[model samples]
Target: MKRAWSPGAVYVEFSSDPRDWPSVGVALLVLVGMGAALVLSFLVFDERRFGCMSGIEIGKTLVQVALRQLAQLASKNDEQLHREREELALQWSAELKAAVPQAVAYLESRVDDLDARIAELSSDPQLRRVYTNFNFEAHREAIDERRRMLAHAAAGLINPEITVERKARVERTLRALDPADILMLHGANLVPGRMRGESLLGTPSGGDDNPGRMRADLLLGTPSGDVLASSGCVRMQVSGGGAGQGVWTEVFITQLGLDVLTALRTYTQNRKLSFVVPGREYKETDRTEEAARKILAALPGLGDLVSWSTRRSSQVERLYDRPRPTRGFAVLRFRMCQWQDWKLRLENLIPIYDKAEVNLVVSAEVQARSRDAKREVFVAQFNGPHDLLRYPADDCEALWT
Candidate 1:
């Protein structure tokens, strides 16, 4: 029953120098090695199967290392993708939202897509065939349904928590602006204000009736569109009208137009063609030069009655009267050259008239150089005290503004 050892079944090898050994001893050693191999073979079936188990352990270790490295790389990639998504989201919410047109377009496109879907649903004949569909116009019926839904949903907000900061910010920004800068203030404070008769027999007049006064802002607007204020209240006066009555009419002059019509002094009461409105705040258009006035006169509103002087073509030697600003009234005098028919220039010319008095412009011909240029003289004349002119006549001054 004992198993026999066979050299063919199992074997061992020796590589040491066997040539130096005794022949019998070597043969005996070889026989013993063979016997040991045969005994080992009887115990185990195959040596290759034992080596295979060790090889499996080494392969498992290599696989675990490779898997760990792959897992780490995948985690890094996931983190990078998350960061990229976050950055993109922030950019969309921040800088992209600031673009007014693009955001509006996106909202409109979404609404339009919804509209298309709603349209498609309403026209679905198959749906109508299946359901107990009543006879209804597609567009009209769809609109009615949408309206009903909108009425209900209107109470519920789509974007209920949008806060806006407009009112206070607008006020703060307006407060920051400097409209009345001193750099814009022009002219010296020449005359300030004067005291006059507090009308005794009047209807509780609470206004100043004084003569010498000027405004702080001497602003001027020119036909050239220049705005400047150069001088303060310049005073003027006028007298002689319906005297000796229980209430005699008296002429008083002050720069109430300037807003500083308090107790002020006289500028130069002597004699001057141009009178200052006292403050530099008068409109720039009011002080436009004669040349610019001519250019504007060709235009609609600009062509109405304006102040100008005239000379007679009959006698160049005769002196012509320039527009003179008096204390209570402004005056313009034009000469009649041949006492001829009224010219077109005279027709278009406006005669100043006040609400209190009605006056007529007796037109005649006069040869005079234009203030713009001392060029060839033309003839036209209008002379009449303006305050005497009344009503619709008074409205003529409006052509200048």
Candidate 2:
């Protein structure tokens, strides 16, 4: 179809065929050009009108971003600083913890060293004397005051009206004082006596007999008080006495008397004097051979085989001479038998056997005297295998004999 167009009027042509239409490429190009132009225009207008405002907003946004970054950096810095502070504090605490014990130990060691040095210095005789003199001079008043107090307490202790509890306390205080001081406060009487002689009063071998003797003289013109006696026999080295006939006496006094005399003597700077009681005397005798004989006599069939001999070596040799068919055990039990009816069991026997020849040389020492001369006797008993000895030996002998 052909279409005519006027200058002022538009002419239109309709066709159902696509070939009659404009090229799609050209139409698209035109439309793209129009859209591009429109966009370009709008961009130009926008650039002219709001370009500064947009720049201001961008600047504001940049400022806000910078501020946030700065704030974050500041927060990080603060956190880092806090962490560093914490670390420093922890480090300091650790250092202190580590150093404190060392310091204390060092101080203690120093103190100990100082004390040791002081002690070493004090050990010198000259230093010790100086210290003693200084101490005596410095504490003289204090010592005097203490002595006065002690004296007051001691005087109060003797007061009859004082309470028992108070007196007890005072007495304790007085005890703490020098014993010489106490003795000087209270007067004491001294009585002297001599030991005349000693006798064998009774024998323990007989019934109802006394076993020991005590010789003491009665004190005269002295207060009724405690008794004190000297220990052992005191030999007085005085003139006009022979060597064997030297004056020997035991002074018996009350216990209080002893204390008072001891205190006075010490206060007066007297020589050492014995103030204890004499111990009982004991005498013993050996009766080994006699006991062996008695024991051999008591045995049933041993009377002929074992003979009593004064020498122990012969008896021991005789025991070994017998034929030892079988291994036999032999025991010799020795004991002290009292003459009185009372018999005490023996302990600790010397073991002897046919195989043990060394034990034959061993001998027991016997006492020569006993406290009771008539009563105590050494007894011996034998125990062995039945094949060794036909009879058991039970015998006794006087230790002195």
| Clash count in backbone of candidate 2 | 26
lDDT (Cα atoms) of all candidates against the true structure = 0.31, 0.34
- Candidate 1: count the clashes: 41
Error of 2 at 246 (Å): 92
lDDT of 2: 0.34
Model 2, span 1-401: residue lDDT tens: 34678888866555567775665556555665555555445543555545667755644544555557668999999999888666654543443344334333322322334345444644556443432332333233234333333333322221222234433433333333443333322221211111134112222221111111111222212222111122111111222235444432223333443333322222222222223212211115423445544544543323422333212322221121111234333434334333122122112223332234222222333343467675444434444532222222212111110
Candidate 2 C-alpha error for residue 331, in Å:
71
> TM-scores, in order shown?
0.18, 0.16
